[model samples]
Target: MKNIVNKTFELFSELEHCNNDQQKWKIEEMDGIMREMSEDELNSVLSARMLNKICQMIEEKKMSMENAILLLKCIGYCTMLKRIRVYCFNDSLVNKRFKTLIVDEYKKKEKKNEKLLVDFCECYISLSIYFPSGLLSVCVPCLQKVAFQKEENEEAQNEVEMALMALSNVKNSEVKKELSLNEITDIIEYHQEHHNLTHLAYQSAWQFLIFRFNMERSLEEVIVNELHFVREAARELEELRECVDWKRREKKKGEKEMKEVLIIGRWLDVIVHFFLSCQLWNEEFFGLIGGIESAFQKAKGEHRGICKECISSFTNIERNRAVTIEDLLKGRAVDAVVKEFQTQTLNNEMTYECLTFLMRVLRRLKEEKDEMGEEKINTIKKKLFEKMEEEGHEDIAISFYEILHFFKRRYDNGLSLDISDYFVNVRENG
Candidate 1:
């Protein structure tokens, strides 16, 4: 490796001032040497030497950007060579110098060509690197472009995914905190569509939002408002749930469809995981619970249980949903939620959750001044209790009395109501 590096340098220096004929011969010799060198295993020193030279040539304008990109494909792109990229990319001096070329060859050219965009993004991953606060600015613009790409090309999209995946790697780095962006919303709005690279793209977008939230103040509006996302997430879940029976149909015909069904089930689980994995400060992200409720309503049997898992997550203290009990009855929304409860009343677990949120929402509504809101709450309370009693759910029916009192002013934070008889009544009736 040392000998080859010395010889390659001598030849490179000669080619810099050689006559045209001599230059041509020197170029051929250099290419031959590079090919030979690449054929051997690349250690950190050799790889850094090549990247250092590439960086120097491009910086000095001695090499055309086009040829530089090609030369990278010839040498820097070796799968085997990448194993040592970890070592080479860690050298801060070399990494810093390569930034200029990355900007010139990749950042500037990303939108003009998908192939370059992919290559650029892959460079982030292929290059095991740190993104100290200011050092990562060069890649930020191109990262946005990669996320919102409209093309359906698999490689291009996969590369976009790779670009996002690279961001995840730096999330724990020393300077990791926030990534400020001028076009954060644009990237998000353009990418509501599901990507070919699902988790990669999803986490990439989510992490960006997370970073911006931590780094940038006054971004609460963007971070919390994603009703469309809720709708699409629920829609995709129901679509996957709808396909569950297809496996049985295929089995009846002896077509062995369980494998395909299993894949769809996994995707449903993916959606579940996507929502469940999110960490956010709880706010009234209106329509989200409604969307989840809608997903729960459409699912059946085993699928319904899966949907319930997601609902149960949102109800927990750590993962509490953005939607509040108040958002439930804001408009005609209460109608659909109540109608569904009426239909699913026989589903004991579903009925219990529905009633819990319903009572809490009614109390929230009662605190509001709108007469219609008050009337709406009374109507909901009447319908809710009647169903609980009609279905003989004594515990759920009686619990509403205490849950609603939670909305009223407390007296010494002690027993405001005579619950001694309430539990006894519930026990006797239930």
Candidate 2:
């Protein structure tokens, strides 16, 4: 720890006096040191003084492509740590200078340094989380151009992925005011039709578009647009269904597949938020209810929770609505929720999500008592109560009580609950 601090100080001093070539070498050394440090060590080393110097190095005009990439990497690492990010954000001069550098780079003619472009996108993304206003204008246009380039190579695909991600992080209303609804439609259309795009890139593209849609459009406008959001969401879910091997019911095996599954899970999560906010409960327009139900039956891990939540939201239609609940209940949705609740250990954020999903199902079953047989409903109630009684789930059961009672007393079931209970549980257990 002492050695890392001393080394950081020495590098800081060397960077101030070094020429361009020596600065490049020292920047590489700094990147290596940062990469090797644990999160604690990195946090400790990124004092306000150290962070300021790093930002200064990034603003250097004569930096080599290699050194630029290295410095971006260093800045990217700094932006990830909350303390360092706060330091960067609070220092207004440093923040504006860094943003100027990024925007100016984006304004230049397309460069040959593909790696530097990718690194810039990634660094901009990390910084945008804390400095969205400063970074969004350059990031949105720069990333959008790359995302639409549709280049058919891995590096291009990687560029598109980072671009999509950088765009997704942006929330500045200044940029949003300039966005055309057609642009949002174009990206979603691209995602739906482009079969060759990598899963990461595909997911990233929709995530950004979805953010823009949810923020810019009201529920009424979403309907007036001819249910574009619902249709596209359904299309993505159907594609996800085709991608999965349903009969196997096997966990997606490899790091790559696991990551894909998790991405799909997160994608479903954002879709859930979109649907809930829009309150687009018409199963007829919200097509592909069956696909969501079928996939939840076989989904494992975090995927299961989101799938179940999707099922919960889709079925949670108003009684007077034109569509019958029976239309969405293609199969035993309650059974999947109960089985997941019974089998899921009292760990993971998924447990809380699944539990909230279960609460919704329980309320729905009680309302339309005829939809599910009394026997099956009682069976589900029994399994849920039994699981809650288990020693490990006591905390969850306690947190579950208020929402459970709210749904029963004819209150607004849409009232939010603290979803952090599971994380708190994990910390205590850890």
Candidate 3:
């Protein structure tokens, strides 16, 4: 096996300088050797050696860039090796296998070859189809390294983006085996943290859920606590946006800042999708709805848009019992529901459901005048006014205004109108 590996590398080395005919003969001979080896033997011996040579070609300063890319692609196709992952390349008198090779080397002031790294990332993502853990072991660390880099410069940002794209590809691909719950928790924690809002690594976001694991029952407890992480991300973004333009805050900032908002959005988006897939939102999970509510309260601009989408996925009742307006107000679920109209983002059906809930709350507030809920009632009033102010606002907004008018009509003269007059006035005014 060692002789065959040496002989194969030597033939390729000569073919680099030989004429076209010699190159064809070398490739044909290499194909014969590959055909002779069993899959298990190739996996154990030949495949690993070929992968090492490919990495060597990448680092060898004497080799051409075109040659390295072509040779790697040839190795991928020729052996059709699915299991072996290359660990080391350079001989820097070291023991680490792939030290800093995952990222492009910072050569002097400029970066080393970037295309080579991208091609390698893409190749590994492809290999992930057969061996999920193999690709993940390599990509996860690189994803973390790039995601947390502190440099604010464009080059640093691009490296982060490249890492995300690579991980996203792996996460996006269909896989056969699911990762264990313990394995997924760290990834979930990383993306959900407030630290990520400033420059979120969108790539690390989806790898956890790519296979749609049966983790709902196993992971529910941790998931409940992890939700607050998304809430903090919103708070961080709100602070950042507020700091950026303290004077005229309504004027949205540059696209770069908006992308920062989206980083949080992307993380929350994955969490929502993963949680819903678990199909295991017990009462405990429902209680943590406050985290999402807090997120809704501070969320603004694009952040609010993301929160609005997140709300639709989490409407659950403990049993056959209905989720009353009182419960929502106490838990601040009203804030999340009201975001749909304040942002004018939800479709007509969801908008109507939200409006119906608010109308019930508004009517109850007018009749009962609960001093305990005074602050919440006031907030609802202000949000309703804001919805009315928005242009092209839907009928749901009008229905809300009519509900307010109905309540006004009932007690305007201290002699409350009868039920019949209430309906009559609402239709006429509406």
Top candidate by TM-score: 2
lDDT of 1: 0.46
**lDDT by residue (tens digit), candidate 3, 1-430:** 3666566667766754655555556666765554344345445444444555545544654344445444444443323222233332222211122334443332324655545555555445423333345445545554445545556577776565545444543433333333334444454565455344224443243434333334244454454345443344335444444434322242345544444444444555554555544444344333445545654555534343545544543343211123333445455565556556554433334444444444544455465447546566555555544543443334445444545434445434222223221121111121
Clashing pairs in 3: none
**Model 3: per-residue Cα lDDT at residue 164:** 47
Score every model by TM-score: 0.42, 0.58, 0.40
Residues 232-261, candidate 1: write the lDDT tens digits.
Answer: 544554444454453243325221223223
Task: Report lDDT per candidate.
Answer: 0.46, 0.53, 0.44
Better of 1 and 3 by lDDT: 1
- Where is model 2 more than 4 Å wrong at Cα? 1-65, 68-96, 103-122, 130-135, 171-174, 191-196, 218-253, 281-328, 344-355, 364-430
Report backbone clashes per prediction: 0, 0, 0
> Which of candidates 2 and 3 reaches a greater lDDT?
2
Residue-level error in angstroms, candidate 3, position 130: 13
TM-score of 1: 0.42
lDDT of 3 at 316: 30
